[model samples]
Target: MPEIRNILFVMYDQLRHDYMSCAGHPTMRTPNFDRLAAKGVRFTQAYVQSPVCGASRMSYYTGRYVGSHGAAWNGYPLKVGEATMGDHLRKLGMDSWLLGKTHMTPDTEGMARLGLTRDSVIGARVAECGFDLWVREDGLNPEGPDGFYYATPSPYNEYLKSLGYPGENPWHDNANAGVDEDGSVASGWLMKNARKGANVKEEHSETPWLTDRCLDFLASPQAAERPWLAHLSYIKPHWPYIAPEPYASMYGPQDVVPANRTEAEREDPQPVYGAFMNNLIGKAFSRDEVRSEVVPAYMGLIAQCDDQFGRLLDHLESTGRMEDTMIVLTADHGDYMGDHWMGEKDLFHDCSVRVPLIIYDPRQSAGSTRGTTCDALVESIDLTATFIEAAGGEVPEHVVEGRSLMPFLRGDTPAEWRDVAISEYDYSCSVMAGKLGVAPKDAVLFMIFDGRWKMMHAEGGFRPMLFDTLNDPKELDDRGDDPACAETRARLMERLSAWSRRVSQRTTISSDQIIARRGKARSKGVYLGVYDENDLTPELLVPITGAAKGDFR
Candidate 1:
């Protein structure tokens, strides 16, 4: 019976669901995350719509599938006029604000064609992927031969320069790199440099900086005016694979278990599988030395993330903001880190597509399910619908493909729910696609997880990749060609085909409005397939017989 005053959706970049101590990580401990899970339902099975950042985040913001929104990869712009969480929450008197990275590339061309400028409110929301960005830093600003990965002279670089750090790109030179004994900069892009401590201090690092920004937002006059959905997205524990101070040396090579791979996976691999295994990033991570140097740093970054998040939680409780605020902790997706001979996410393995989803609903109904783990299938996009519902608004069925998780939070079993979870990827823009000689239009991949057997459907005539996740929990074995799995494969293929045919394009109007407007056209004096006036129903003909409706033609 308690009312929801605000929401905080926290997304950590590249955090694996299993890496959390509550989720069974042997080494990493996230006590603050554990505290949140203890007060709410922890979903053991949560899948994102895509394995990559931009596409998956678009799904989270829009509450639609990848195919529905059409922003398929990073740097790919989310088209203008999509109904996003901000649009929905704004209608319900809740403001949606962004604190950190969204990986959003504004649809500049689309906005230009529509005569929209970023200076306007509607245009600014669309430009930021439907959120009022308070501070946005993607946190990875590598300079390639062509140009920088993101805009040069970013806010983060300025902040570092303000703190007395030298150089044009302090973000890369100091924050992500270290000084060797020779006094030269060691770039962290290479795994060999990961063990070295970054030049920046822990207090000024990315995660801690973002946490400070969150505190600033909470104390701002705008946040105090009304209810808000704060998307405190952190770009950390992702790449550059370096940490500052004690965090870089906290864990060693011995702490990490061996990378999850096998020699059998290399021999006679599938076309797409072999392509990814031999790709640029893939081969680098395949080396044992690379995995050894990188995993420790990766683990340390996750530790930093845990500490920073716990810091935010402490501030919330001290300010008494946790009483009516619903908080959701999740990730865009996870990194592979040499798993399946892959360096980064692009596959459908649990290491890639699955993410941590923990929600704390500070309401009386949620108390019964507190500290409980839910094995029910959950999707990242579902948070959009859940946020809308928490704001006391109904989800627009035609627009949002994700269902609300509120029923689960209330300790009630929904009478109906989806039987399978879905994830998709468009690798046409990836170098791996070129290695396979795949056409741009045919480089898509889809994953269907039915709570047991998972099937990865590849385009361009590549056969489906199947894995018995329950029996072979590590997913090292690919049962795609096994004759015994033909039945399961066919069933999943049928399900995939059915999912493809969903009503994904009709976003302007809600299905409820359609149902409510049913049969009203004829009553408003428009008639169809009537051979004579007598053929129509008496009620329908009342308008036709009226002086206003008759013989106008």
Candidate 2:
């Protein structure tokens, strides 16, 4: 057999596509990611099949829709017999290993035979997802001694704690707080452990540790022989946005903070956890400090990740693996950061759903396709198929509904890609209502983004949101009812309805004798929110009594 060239998958949890400099956001400092974009292909309209973590990742690993794999939410796991990306790679005689956080299953064995036991921590997920090396902490955030807030003082936590402003007592250090507006007082504790002299693994935080692992993988005997897939997942910039020295002081809150929201955008429905968003703005710091400072700190975290990636790239070149390897970079989902007055994802919106996707392939249809950007709609589901193709394996017939993005990446044929992207979110909001003994009135919502227009439809609510993305890029106005775009609205409704039917059917395995040989599993995709089709577009909602019996499109 020919020598196996490794593939690298770098995922940043909750990173929005538009926030990175390579994605064309002018201010964010992401030289490393931007450089990857420059050397390879950037997807302009990439989206995830589901907004939530486990579901979107399931789609990525299986190349199947969330409706196909049983893992649907953060709490869900891969159903027995479902194939993962690693499983497919292993079948092709390649050794597949998982190093970091595997939320679907807490252990490395959760998916396939590979590296390391599962710690299920954010740091570990980063290591296992793409990196061949491993050092991780699984389980929830460690509790503080006083029980007032979450803290991790494990040997790992102690190392991280050492990075904060020196205090004889770590608890007295005010780690959870942020810097004052003038950058005088400290707020929360810094997460990068090895930065200090404290004893910790080389791969820690969102950058240094992750890059170090990548370099290690490249220099090891494995790089000299076999093809490997390394995932370096970063937990920073997600929340508690506490960065250290240079990163913390690199930018000001006013310099890069997001713009204020208008009343119209704020009027939209607030997720039940409204207090978290409020606290993000001002509670962490004293008066004179608005929430804007967090942006620079967040950007600093991004820069840190970028710097680490630059180092990894240099190592790959030094090891002579750059030409033979393929690099894929993306994120599981996105964070709102105050967009729509929300902090964490689980809401259905572009801010929470669209993620940065970049693919760097050594083989090109035309030499030097640097900085090539494709606007063709792409989703995370397509990743499994792309990887399978790159690794010389046939993409299983029933694996995923997503098509390979290679055509778009090569820029040789743009006509083959999908014209629109779809997004779905499982509603924790509705579930909490039921838990609180309240009526769950809202049905789950689904969105379809055609090139020119974006339509948001909720099953329970009749209010449909239509945004002419070209005119209102911020998506501030809901024009679903505008009479001028009735035809466009009707077309989008059909598309949305058809999509629902398709995924719903594929949610389960076929009982056919042929399919049985392939060992398929039933899907556990979560459906959230409630909507009235008539309210959004009466023409599209049909008078039905039960479930959709077959494909509607």
- Could you tally the backbone clashes for each prediction? 0, 38
Assess every candidate by TM-score.
0.96, 0.74
Model 2's alpha-carbon lDDT is 0.61
Model 1: worst 10 consecutive residues (lDDT sum)? 543-552
Candidate 1 Cα outliers beyond 4 Å, as residue runs: 537-553
Scored by lDDT, model 1 comes in at 0.91
Residue-pair clashes, model 2:
38
Which one is best on TM-score?
1
Residue pair clashes in candidate 1: none
